[model samples]
Target: MRVKDFIWLSGLLTVISLPLSAAENDWPVYGGDNLHQRHSKLTQINKSNVTGLIEAWEFDTGVNDTFQATPVVQDGVMYVSLPFNDVIALDAATGKQLWRYQHDLDKDYPICCGSANRGVAVSNGMVFTGTIDARLIALDAKTGKKRWDHRVIGENTGISEDASKLEDTELGSVSGTSGAGINMAPMIYQDTVIIGITGVGYGLHLDAVDSDSPLGTVVGIAGKYGRRGFMAGYDIHTGEQKWQFDTIKSENWEGNFVTKTADGVELPRNITNEKAALQENADAWRYGGASAWSTPVIDPYTGILHFGTGNPSPQMEGSSRPGDNLYSSSLLALDASSGDYRWHYQQVPHDLWGYDVASPPVLFDITIRGQPVPAIGQAGKTGWFYVHDRRNGNFLYKSEAFVPQKNMFSLPSAEGTIIYPGVMGGANWSPVSVDARRRLVFIPGIHWPVEYKLHQQAASEGKDAVRYSSMSPINTPEKHGLLTAIDLDSGKIVWQVKTENPLIGGVLSTASGLVFTGEGSGELMAFDADSGEKRWSGKTDAGVNAPPITYRIDGKQYIAVAVGGNRLFGFKTGQKIKVWRLP
Candidate 1:
């Protein structure tokens, strides 16, 4: 925290706290009403009329870079975060730029392969966004004027004035560490805005061959190099700190050292070796790398918030940090007001592979054995859609793998080992859409494989002599995407449509029996929500690599998405937001 933030907090403590509120019909929340469903009830552009849907308007932000924001539509205006955490307000029907806020970034701001901001949150007459420099800013909804700015994370890692001169710069990706940044859109609940930090975990990234190829090799270095990650809530009115929940468990983080997952999936581990190493390294949890990157879903009735956690520290190699890393790679249930932990379900205990619970959790009601039960669903890097009891974090069942799964839990070898649904995941940070009325969930999937190989070497002549091992990737590979519809009751796939490139963005399903999503190939597509048939597509100048949103203004329905492509995933980059309607 900075001195200015402390002064702001001190002033906020003198004011009274009031509850926040949200708009029902507009796309105000990140996942549309805090359920994280990404589904809309508008039916103007139905299945029968979707074929005639055409471009209504387009706005280019003039920056040819990664744009992954989901526009927040309220009243008649659309608020979106452009590349580099910039913001713009446009007329929903005409795409006329009403206001634009140029984010002034620090010259030495810590960043990585690309600048990607998911979106923004609009609540209580204000628009809020988290920046790439790990700061949160609030703006007046009507005027786009800055209200208050606060540093969300500590500034120990990259605050030095002369940090650029270091070869392996502190908080730089080349040094096996990254600075805290807000890649997730803030979730504004009643009177409190919730947000999390990412890039706390260390992984090597290689250059992709082209725009259509899969991501380059992900190298996981084995050592202590990352800081702990957290999610916190702030006062919507005064910008005061409310409460925070740390992702990494500090005390008793090495829980039970369970050899298999709670559901009895066998994990490849040497328990004896892990138990022996635990005594010497009991404090490793202080630097665990369980970053909370995705936005959270809240049950408005009970105020119970549900979200997923990222991979454990020293990601791929787990020799130094022993025991089951509690809370990492799991689904968490917490009290929305107090930030108290209620329950957790770990997906991979002692995770040696980079399998994270990367997608946002979706809340819906499901019939269990003949009765209605509240359920939470999440798509994993492990290639399955896991359904659980929303209140208790109990696993109900897992759907059939959406993407192909091979050598899922295999150990990395001296000779390379092929692993399907690699670090990017069967669904990576992409929000799934659910039509509760139809009992169907729409998932965007990827089929990118990684060749995990281990490299062992002798100590070098100059540096510290620590016997370390690294996991590296093999070669450049081709990939594809899948749009899958699954039956919520049977946990089975109803239909799947394959695309040319891996689907790295998200899906949106509407009451009109239509599904809309984007691709790395620069195509914004619409499909028959029931049969998985392509109904319409509009080619763009760049990849449509962001979630599409739908809202109604003046009796007209419009679908909008950020067409600015993704750079890390080998997608052509640009800065364009395109909207469509029946023309």
Candidate 2:
């Protein structure tokens, strides 16, 4: 292959918006670009002046719960989303709230995950977000007023009004269940606006927000007209649907429940949109796991859509759906144009720990062996880090090991040992930073256990009885969290900075010869990309799940982070975005 073509095919240079230092390099979308690199090109805030950073300003985001919002900045204006699904436009330099678009979320949200709004995607002079309340909203980039609202999920997505209004009746309960809602920021690929639904049969059933009947199809709505998740494309100016993809089957679903164990293969309690329909073979989609819950990474150049899946339903039980659930807890590669599964890698076969591969996959090319190849490195919620070939989902580097015989799966020869990073992900929802300079992937990871206790009406009615329906907070069993630098080529840990709390928030590395990391304990820190020594850090009001960003306004280098305990990540306070400028 030609060197240039080989590098492109190797997954290097995903054609993301080349950050141009100023407004040109704005961290505008979730993952920074379609590839979700969470990387930046600014070097002004490098290791040299990093320690001199002093608080410039702070904005009151007014949120409660662990907020993990990646702010989108455009034209000197910053757009941030929060746990309550509130979108606010702020002055980029001053941190002043310009306009706030509240999602109208109630104190009680019916979903397993706590209140978290990943963030927003902007284009054509409008800010877009998939709301916790199940609506896809577009706002004026300048004023933050709602331009149009398309009920992408919930009742607006064709849900019954009564059903849509159901409260998160199961929070703090043992069942630990939540209903349908949009949490991941809506993905914008070129002109088509894509969104996915998480939470699950939650309090409702699977397919609760499976909106639009045929359920589980990647709907592409138009940017112009207001089309909702219906029809197809919306006019760039009209917001109308131009086209649509529906999950309709020619026949009813059919599949016998795994009444008897075979080779002790766990019976699949759930199925994919395809299997769900096949198992029913009747006319309805099954009620188990099988939902599109993660934001997809797009190969803007190749137009391939890569997304991860959630656990097959029944929450914690895997015996329900056995035999390597086709796509659940899997990484799927599809033709962005046709939505066809080109290839897939099941991170967890029939996941029982509820280890959903819902985290965003970071894409970049690694100089493997002697050839630079296109590959992906992913950190899942369960804490597993996987480096695979993006072109075909092949393992490029294997650092984290499999569970071996820990998970009771009888193998002819141990197959591919399930060495997942764990549900909290060796790298979780908190993103990682990719340094092109050193070709290293900087990931903050959680090393904790999520001991699941089978919920059986829990004898009577107490906390234990309703725990499954709750979001488990962080408890790091004393093992210091790690900020691991992995040699992408070898999947080898170059250097690991062990901190007190789990290395929780996202990461950003700069060309200025420095790397930035955050913690769930309100600690924003800096480290030498080449060394593991901590050069600086500071305590704020809450944990830092929100990644840090750097930019230059008037030749002065600046750093910033959103301080709010991720109610979901174990933090309970903090409501401001703190900025620091080099003195």
Candidate 3:
């Protein structure tokens, strides 16, 4: 019974649990609340009228490719989740549409990065979503139909057995050989629902040859590919299964092999060939690959649940997945009802530079020393903005390097290296926004610097001779985008700005001082949440990447987003959704 007496009796059953909240004008869920705090208490549209806004409607969803969701809304409808998980309800004031459900994509499973989905979760009257082939479905929030589907992984679960001779090469045509699915965005918490599991740290991406343009080389390859990566809980009526957790730790997952970084940084390990290859990778947590990407930040006064975890499998080639991958690039914390394990902070233990805590964790409270605490911010892809201690994941400070870190943890080189926030991040799966009365925190970074390299391929004819690692973006530092705002009690950098295009997508903050974001060049912008100033922008035909939300109906105050673009950074897709108001 002692694991520090069950974490001090789970912090006294999380300080007498029962709060739940979320309705301050409704964006409903997925960063708007459950402490995701995408902030927006609705103050009409500030920064002096947000340039008089305009265009209060625009619904398309005709199925564009990487849109990346983030629409939610409630009582006034608006559900929105496309790029193939399909399910739209819209009408949050005239963007009409009412009911659509669709979904169906099994196409023999295997999905990774481009089937998008990121947005759903409305309570009891249903509307859940989490698909791209790992299933989960719910729908029926006033006629979108289908109530209950749940198949979160298990058809060929993790494929590999030479997955039909590696599906005929080029790493199975750029990773479609199965990375398992469910691109996050499913939260509920009372009768359960929660979600997770994403391309299980897969790898081998390679895209930009002008197929719209952005992510050109990812690679990874050093065998056993990927598998374990969980976070479950279902049964918001009958999808059944409850409580799952498992982001690789079937037994010490090699923890304590720490060569630094619980803040002290260092890590370029070898720890003597990883303790002489830890008994031949001791079952490598059965293909352990962490991938829960983002969408979890519960803490309703402490029932815990925070999220983040990605990169570990063969990703960036960490010697057959050796040690310190415990909860892969960690930030976990659970017990939202029963998934247990209460704390973890690990931002990049043995991560080999994919550095993924893929952004999404933002509770808030802060004060410290003068004592108020309960913290948990998190926008790192190794470019900082950490914060922690939401109960006991501890660390407590780190902000001020929104995007630009140069050789960070180093390692992969057969003559390449470079590194600045590589692996497409400095907040990838983007989602960060919390003004909690100006304690600030608004990040949306990604300066894109990669190179890395390491390759060696040979043995063809019948396959079997590889060892890889690749990452690309390093043409000489031109990529851009950052937006920061820090301050969380002086972890300082209270104003950052600089975006021409590398920002992924997500950030909203408001009470009306303002902070909205979007771009791959279709600009949605608006700033000055406290002097970052670029007050308003708006134009969009595509590439708003995804994430921007706000609500309120009869009394106006709109501003939604999800203009399709972002086919893994090439941007410019399009199926619209738009919204906006004031005028």
User: How many clashes (backbone atoms < 3 Å, residues ≥3 apart in a chain or on different chains) does model 1 have?
Assistant: 2
Q: How do the residues 1-583 of candidate 3 rate in per-residue lDDT, one tens digit apiece?
A: 6443443333533432212344677788888766777887778788877898989889887887778889889878888888878888978999888888887887866566567888888887888888878889887899988977978766545535332323334433453344577878888888888898876775655432532233566666655767888898888988887879889898989888889888888888988898788788787777778888788878765577889888777677778777897898788998988998988888888787778788788876666656455677888887888887788887878877887788888887878888888777788888888786777888888887888878666677877676676777765548888888888877878779888888888888787788899997798899888888897899988889788988887788898898887876777888888998987
Per-residue accuracy of model 2 over 165-256 as CA lDDT, tens digit each: 21233221112233556777666666777766665422222233322211111111101111111112233344544444322112221222
lDDT of 1 by residue, 341-400 (tens): 999999988787777888899987676766556688999888999999886888999999
Candidate 3 structure, TM-score to reference:
0.34
Number of the predicted model whose lDDT against the real structure is largest: 1
lDDT of each: 0.79, 0.59, 0.78
Sequence-dependent TM-score of model 1: 0.91
Best by TM-score: 1
| RMSD in Å for model 1 | 7.8
Candidate 3 — which pairs collide? none
- Which portions of model 2 miss their true places by more than 4 Å? 1-24, 106-112, 154-178, 201-285, 291-293, 381-383, 401-423, 454-479
Per-residue error for 503 in candidate 2, Å, reads 2.7
The superposed Cα distance between candidate 3 and the true structure at residue 235, in angstroms, equals 36
